[model samples]
Target: MGDTPTTIWPLDDARPGEVVVIARWSPSAGKSETIAALLPELIQQSRAESGCLGYQAYRPDGADNGDLVLVERYADQSALDAHRNSVHFRTLVLERIVPLLADRHAVVTTVQ
Candidate 1:
């Protein structure tokens, strides 16, 4: 395992009605395409959810851990919860995604 980048966003200084979710995923079986294919569905589901503020994905340059990051913001905790419980999330994780990932990390926080 490599040293994964630690990303901490200060919600205390964030704007009102903002929530944050950060995630990192590493590919298994040398297959990044599987992860990439699933992203659009994830983003669409997240963006369509009520109270979504913003959602984006990123890949770090020159990272050894095959790091892929997802950054998402919502209007509040309830919205974040809805995102977590969304069908698209469930389907992707259970049906299409988990088997392809070597590692995963996530942090969800509310803006103070």
Candidate 2:
């Protein structure tokens, strides 16, 4: 399959051929184990989506405890929207995982 390009309004800095989402999550007090347990399933299901080009979760070496970084690539804006509205995203991320997080930050970008 080939890459699909996308554009974001206003700022308009995104390049063509895929949208990338970078997110950081910090688990709430004593909720680290729970968040970790949810990662594998989340990653697996997300990667299985047709619009998802890639889905990966990371923990920085020497970084603060219970911090997770997720890097995801999708075909385009529609693909990303579909992912955000997907059943797995709603259930596993918004409901199960988000409730255990102290904070979460995400940014959308594209290849230069």
On residues 1-112, what C-alpha lDDT tens digit does candidate 1 reach at each position? 1124564442334676588988888889667877787788778777888888777777877866557887788888888878778888788865677788888898887666
Give the alpha carbon lDDT tens digit for every residue of 46-109 in model 2.
Answer: 8899988877777766857778888888888899999999999999999999999999999998
Clashing pairs in 2: 5-17
**Winner by TM-score:** 2
Taking all chains together, the TM-score of candidate 2 against the true structure is 0.83
Q: How well does candidate 1 score on lDDT at residue 54?
A: 74
Reference-based lDDT, residue 22, model 2: 87
Candidate 1 Cα errors over 4 Å, as ranges: 1-14
Q: Native-vs-model 1 lDDT?
A: 0.75
lDDT of 2 at 29: 90
User: Residue 84 of model 2: what lDDT?
Assistant: 95
lDDT per model, in order? 0.75, 0.81
What are the per-model numbers of colliding residue pairs?
Answer: 0, 1
